[model samples]
Target: MTTRSCLLPPSIIRPGGRPLLSTGRAAARAALIALSGLLWVGALATPPPSSLRGADAACVNCHRRSGLGSIEGHIAIPPIAGPYLFVPRGERLAELGIPFVDTARINHDPYTDESLARAIRGGIGANGKTLNYLMPRYQIDDATMAELIGYLKGLRVSPSPGVSTSVLHFATIITPDADPVKRRGMLAVMNQYFVDKNNAVARTKAPTLYSSHTTMFRVERRWQLHVWELTGAPATWEAQLRKHLAAEPVFAVISGLGGSHWGPVQRFCEEQSLPCLFPNVEAPTGHDSDFYSVYFSRGVLLEAQLIARELADAAEPANRVVQVFRAGDVGVQAARDLQAARAHSGQQIVNRVLPAHATSKDLGAALRDVDAADALVLWLRPGDLSALEKVSPPTSRVWISGEMGGLEQAPLPASWRAAARMAYPVDLPGRRVVRVDYALSWFRIRKIPLLAQQVQADTYLACGLVSETLNHMVDAFVREYLIERVEMALDHRALTGYYPRLTLAPGQRFASKGGYIVRFSDPQGPRIAALGDWITP
Candidate 1:
């Protein structure tokens, strides 16, 4: 029921006639602890006595709710969990029933209650060295400080259920609506990646030590992949995912496959705080606040932006833009995005949505109204593109989705190629030949059928990314750390297949940023030409 002013330190008066601390330094240290421990106080001029979650909020922002800490640029925020802080410099954490993390310093001496308090108040480590400048000094009373340290001692991060001394388990999800070819391709890449990983680890005689320390050594753990194939309707996918996750606990979801709706899968990952990285889905969850899911791009949404940019800058743009898509498909979102983008541009946007299982006969109805003064935007799959033979396209301007229509191989008829420009969200085919063909060669060697080229290539890239991140992680198997490491390492990768260059950061879920608007160079063939330089719109 009591509150304290944020400007002032922890109350000087103690309840029940008890001394908060024996010395003035200890009292100041407690106030310092309270100041550093609770971040919410800074936002309010007056904070309640219970603000730091009172005994429950030892590690706040930056360290995160997981207490696993985070990295920014060159600064490594050390883990404050019980095992990381209390263990001796020469001791192995795993042996002490503690999980290992690369962020935890093994060379640092162990901390006692008194030394820990001194370090908290004075900004000095147990080794008598000053801590990083990013770490702030705080002020709190003695009793509260003792309670905070006790809370930290109680915070422990033992290995998750999927992690073990000899193996690390990961799951790849496949929705019932996912394309069969892409599913097969993703699983093939994941299986091959695991086999290659174990073989490489086997070559090393022993787990390599990170530094010249007896306590620190990278334990060789074989990668284990669990396939979660979800059946039934989209509404039930999240429940099915929960059941599968409970039945087979995986450290994270990697390189999955999905179709028109990946919302259930996205929800499952967000709710569980499970890392779902780079699943091959055209329409991914658009919520930017969700941290657990990352994608290669905004899928069709990025294409919408690309098309909108082209439309917005035209010397004499179309007076009316007509967009056509399936009723319940990912294209629906893409069409809506384009409409919103060009809303105030004095262009009348029209949406012609066909049924989910629309036949070729239905194409005529959607294209009937499009004419010379209107831009025809097609948010459709290869089947729908092929169905366009039933009707002629408008003479104004035509934009087709390269991703949904199968990239350069989009089955648009020869008649349409001269007029239609594809929203190509990857590097040009000629430039990406070496990058893509390298994966194709590997597929041949492994005897994995290359049915879905883009899906397979992206899956291969995702597997390689996970492997590289784990190598950088050393022996740390923390789930949150894995996601953080992937974010940091993605930008440095030089061999990103399919995509021009993949990149991600703290809040960025999509890796590839932009693409080109291209048209068929020759009417009869698969070769395409870009209209201009890359645009990130």
Candidate 2:
């Protein structure tokens, strides 16, 4: 629980504002008076005032937004939900059909309206025992206390939508502009994963007993996946998603694919309070305050930062940095992010945006004005990279988007490869082979075609993570709790696929926070060497 500081008198002064004598009987009387004053101060200070909303706000910090208490270190903050608090004595929680919560205080005396109020205001339990020291004693009026009690009673621990007795329904969203090959590969992995999951538990219909002593459990549920493919303008994607959700409600959206604009889908998830986990998006939307919509990385925006960091630390920073990208591509945002990162650096940032359907001639023209002293950044796709053969290397100080140009397999011309460094935002090929091969080996055994290796591996990883988190949650299927569990579980993941490590906390939406800056080891083939260690900018 959150603690606040209080101001107490620094010295024992007389009521007439004079310092008391330090010796003999006067000192004794003053000590007694100070002790009485301290008791009064504690009463007034402990439970500040009757601001009901403020007091209740503290409940969320301690008990969590779900009203399902969490364990901090060795301390078990028990659930304060109405069912857990008011369940009658001698009544088995499983008999009442209440799901097993790890933090539940079982077999305790039930709290009445009066006792519960006493517990809140006086830090005394219904059993006439003192509550945990961490539990603050709030002082509120009768009406306000009643309203708060009513609010806590209203908190239900009912199962969320798409959670049936024998099925846990989930969805995967795909935008119209997403790559067809990657989409096919992602769906292939997702389908095979679901089949393997159910096959492993085909004959196991036993209740999911989370405890050894109690008869508390829920029927094991088969996993179900729904593919929600959006077709139309980005503006209409949200409405389409809502319609699909209305037709086929899901507990969460997982491992979705997107293109330049994943904003509508991200916004829809946040608005619906739905968990959108680890979507494959280049330019992800939303700030730290966003509750739903977690991603593996920031994608190209992350690459931009890597490049900006390189420029900032350069022995002789470029006089002017030039960024070239096609119009309406996700690179536009990447370029803007780079510019913003270097806003206070005093160096010039020049943008050269080509036509959306730019030809080799137009691409050459976009690079023609670059000076030898200026740093060049190419935020182009493979096709545009191949077209760069028509133009000479305008600057020796050059950086390219490893993400947009397809990582190590980017089709950069030999001349540009010799001069350019790559903003490598994923684990290097050699470092991640073993972890990545785990997925590859599974695909080989399942005979699932490896069309898009990265996307498929990430999708497989997402499915495994969600499955693991659900297992940890036991029978609690609350959406908010799902997000909370993900935040807690990510740091413990060992096989994080392409990323070196994945981590998230309350406000962190991006799991992988850093990447490497690399350069081509040779003029030919897809061989690269890191210029330095991983950078988190």
Give me the candidate number with maximum TM-score: 2
List candidate 2 segments past 4 Å from native: 1-57, 207-215
lDDT of prediction 2: 0.81
Highest lDDT among the candidates is held by which one? 2
Question: Which stretch of 10 consecutive residues in model 2 shows the poorest summed lDDT?
Answer: 10-19
What are the per-model numbers of colliding residue pairs? 8, 0
lDDT per model vs. reference: 0.76, 0.81
Candidate 2 per-residue lDDT over residues 217-279, each given as its tens digit: 545679999999999999999999999999998989989999888999988987777899998
Q: After superposition, how far is residue 175 of candidate 1 from its true place, in Å?
A: 0.7
lDDT of 1 by residue, 81-193 (tens): 65688888887776775655556786878998877877766667889998765554445446655865755664446555688788888999998888887888788888998
What would the TM-scores of all predictions be? 0.84, 0.87
Weakest 10 consecutive residues, lDDT, candidate 1?
9-18
